[model samples]
Target chain A: MIGCGWGLVYGVLNSLSNIMLLPSAPFISIRPQIALPMAVGILLNPPAGFVVGFIGNMIGDGISGFGIWKFWNWHLANGLMGFIPGLIRYFGIVKIGTVREFGILQMSVVLASGIAVAFAVLLDVCFLHHMTFPSSFPSWILPAFLTDAVNGFVLVPVILLAFRKILLTLEIRTICLVTILLLLAVFSTAVSITLSILDDLVSQEAVIENFYIAGIVSVFLLVVGFLASVVFVRRFTDPVIRMSRASQEVESGHYDLSLLDPVSSRNDELGRLSRVLQKMAKTVQERERSLRQQVQDLQIKIDRKRKDEEVREIVETDYFRELKKKAKAFRSS
Target chain B: MAKIIAIHSFRGGTGKSNTTANLACLLAREGYRVGMVDTDIQSPGIHVLFDLDTNDIPYALNDYLWGKCDIARAAYDVTKTLGADATGRLFLVPSSIRAGDIARVLHYGYDVTLLKEGYRQLIRQLPLDYLFIDTHPGINEETLMSIATTDVLLIILRPDQQDYQGTAVTVEVSRQLEVPEMYIVLNKVPVRVDREALAAKAVSAYDCPVVGVLPHDEDMLDLGSSGIFSLRYPDHIISREMRRIVQRLTP
Candidate 1:
């Protein structure tokens, strides 16, 4: 039920992107729709991903007045794009928890796009008897792979983020910013290629070639940037996370702060903060101990009010008054 | 005229008798002719502390209260018993320890007036500079009569909850009687207690001067009531504290 419902939605979205007149290569439409099935593949099951991609592409082709069975190779290519990332289910990762898992999710998307496009090219060459090899590589294979790979790479994390499948840690936040930059780079390059085609600024073949190269270069840059961000952000935020955990320990009345030694020795603001926290805990512990001792030694319980009343009972008597008179008379005598 | 000093407590076993015996020896050591009367008629134990043997009593305070003898006849010059080097004379009017004598005083009760007259007779006869009244614990008619005539009142107590409450009442009573001078003496305090601090606390507690906070002495306990603690351990910590109390009371 989920597969058919999502497949129809993907088909409608694909048709909508086509109508939007976005910057794209000749005969290769800019397909942000590529991320939808890949996200579903990773989020849902692999078979569900295949069903969404295959059936969705078929519905899309039929809606655009292109015969669905005519380019059956393209439907299979899209299906494989979703199916490869869906293989992530075997890693026991229902959601991205660490930097390594995030890398795997993105790498699978890129890997799936390359293999899927290659599979289609091989089928078109062997079964359909499509003309030419080296010439077809640039126009069909390169364009197909770059379009799917870049779109899926940039948008899958975004979809996963929106769906709450990824935790918004420091590493994930940096990666989110990096994805937006990649999308901007991809968008600008596509627009320049489209302008080149429309205004006749350069030869179409040369322009298309440069577009594919720029797309691939940006993907590598995004990968390197993602890795560097993971390293840098993890370094900055781990100490904070550790200190937060130690503070919780202190709150619960456990003053064993052996874990904070490294953080406290850093000679930074956080280290100074750690030292202050440690001193506060020690002071609290000392006060508690001394309080217990003082309660024993310093207190001598006596009720003065009650004693004053009791003393009044003996003094306010006729016998005491007469005795006081006789005692005073004798002392003067 | 001798200055009458009454030593008292609201509860027994606060070392009241022992402290009286120690102070008498301490005062005489300073060459003041001191006279002490064991007014703890119901259960008198002060005579034992002065090493006054049971058989040596020709007359106790019981004889004078009964009008059987003059109060001076009951007075014994106990100064020589503390050693011949003692300069000033020290006298003790010990309470009788005989079974019938104790029972008659408890049963018929002594005239409280005679105690003041006896104190006057002792001062005139022996010409004492200081007269010590070793009072029985707790409030009684005679205890009040003794307190009423005193020039100075010393309330002794131990570091105990019952003692704390009892001493507080005794302090209020002495204050109401308009005693000329008043002070507290904390005795048999735990040796580990901070003496200076306890002394300060007691002063603030009673709104009265604290002349002493005496530590519990093992030797004093070992000696029990058979001998004077100040004379036996002249330079002992307890003796030193007692001497300090004497210094505060010297005027």
Candidate 2:
């Protein structure tokens, strides 16, 4: 239920944000395709898919202009999209075994979500706002449909793929660093937006002054972000350099050194290099094992050769002694 | 510096991921340090080839994106999982499979440049001899950025009409991006199909080197993302073809 609630919130927020941003870039509008699956996954699993989507979407929507009342209805409609898909899949009405199957499921939910959002928008415009469905409904609907389809078909899969890729990479420290960066971005964006809005409500001179202040602040934040990222990258690179050095040492038969700690710093790059070193260490260990086996085999061969030499020496001594005794006896006779 | 090789297909189901995984594994077997990244974050599935269960994945690309973990922490070292004969190291950076991560990213969207930075970071930090990026099929910010940064770009396609057109688009994009080296890998060709003719036709059409023409192998389907195909069936025809592709990739 909480998942569904979160999905509802995310759906509404995602729809609202897309609507707000739709005027500027029609091709890049937000859609509920991702939110729907996310909501369903979250509602079913909690704090997994639904919560993130819900929180993200709500934040995005809140950034737009939906009122509390309208937000609730929007949430309900959006939440339904996720709930329906989950229920259908759970009931075995839809199968999701392969990549293709998953794609189809995403399309269906997205299409359904698009329809629901359209209805919600229509309700808001006609009944709530007391305005006619804009002369732009046809144009808007098509783009919305396309955008949602793209979101479902393209974006959803990409997200899943990225998720899977990240899991495989297993760079937790990078994740934390990136998260901090994103939070900073969000915080910076919020502050900038707030300042601009405040400046708008004030006098011209105050607005100008505020704009100047905000610009300076934005630049400072951006610089900080860049510097932090650079530091992180540098930290990441240091380990790779160390790992390479260690690898070179190992190549020269120095196996006592261990891999550098990639996560010693908050840099994502170093952590990745550390992983490579760890991998290199494993390869070195295997080589060491093979080398050990070869040495043992060589030792056995050496022992066998020594035994053969001892046998040859004994045979030679006996033959020579016999020959000498025969010659003496012959001479004496 | 490790050479970053990106494998892309214009259309879906062109065997991009499988080909990437196989090539990476084959290179690793030959004592090369190879890393594979499934940058198709929206629909990630390469972990299956590495026998990685979702439960086993503690971090992912989504986690990296959401600031929950470092990209390196997301890399799973599957070399040990592969076995004793596998001398090369294989680390996989998988995308998140969780629905929430997917939704949050789509709804919020992150900086495309950040993803590019992540790629460069992965290459430099991992010190990868080869970083294979299995990208999403079509052109996107991430795909274009990866193409722009890659040292070698391998475009995978089948002998289908749709694929031909799509491959042309990707080839053109890679050319426009001025990728240092570009090669086309013709995959899933029928056994009865004339290899020489296919290669010639594809080469003439793309005006690029046809690195390898791999026959459709039933063994791949039977394995079904269970493990790296080339490593499991080293002597198989498909694996042999994959080796040819790897040879071209190597200096």
Chain B TM per candidate, please? 0.96, 0.95
Per-residue accuracy of model 1 over B1-251 as CA lDDT, tens digit each: 57899999989998998898889888897788999999998888888776786567788899999999999999888897567787788999998999899999888997888888888889989989999999989998888988888989999988877888898888787776778899998888776667788777778778999988888878988998888878888889889889888888886
CAPRI-wise, candidate 1 is acceptable
Q: Proportion of native contacts found in each model?
A: 0.55, 0.00
Q: What stretches of model 2 exceed 4 Å from their correct place?
A: A1-333
Tens digits of per-residue lDDT for model 1 on A85-180?
A: 999879877878567788889899999999998888888898875636977766677777887898898889889988888876655665666666
**iRMSD per prediction, in order:** 2.5, 36.8
Task: Tell how far residue A78 is off in model 2, in angstroms.
Answer: 99
Q: What TM-score would each prediction reach against the true structure?
A: 0.51, 0.42
User: Of the candidates shown, which would achieve the greatest TM-score relative to the real structure?
Assistant: 1
Backbone clash count for every predicted candidate, in the order shown? 0, 62
TM-score (C-alpha, index-matched) for candidate 2: 0.42
Candidate 1: lDDT over CA atoms?
Answer: 0.82
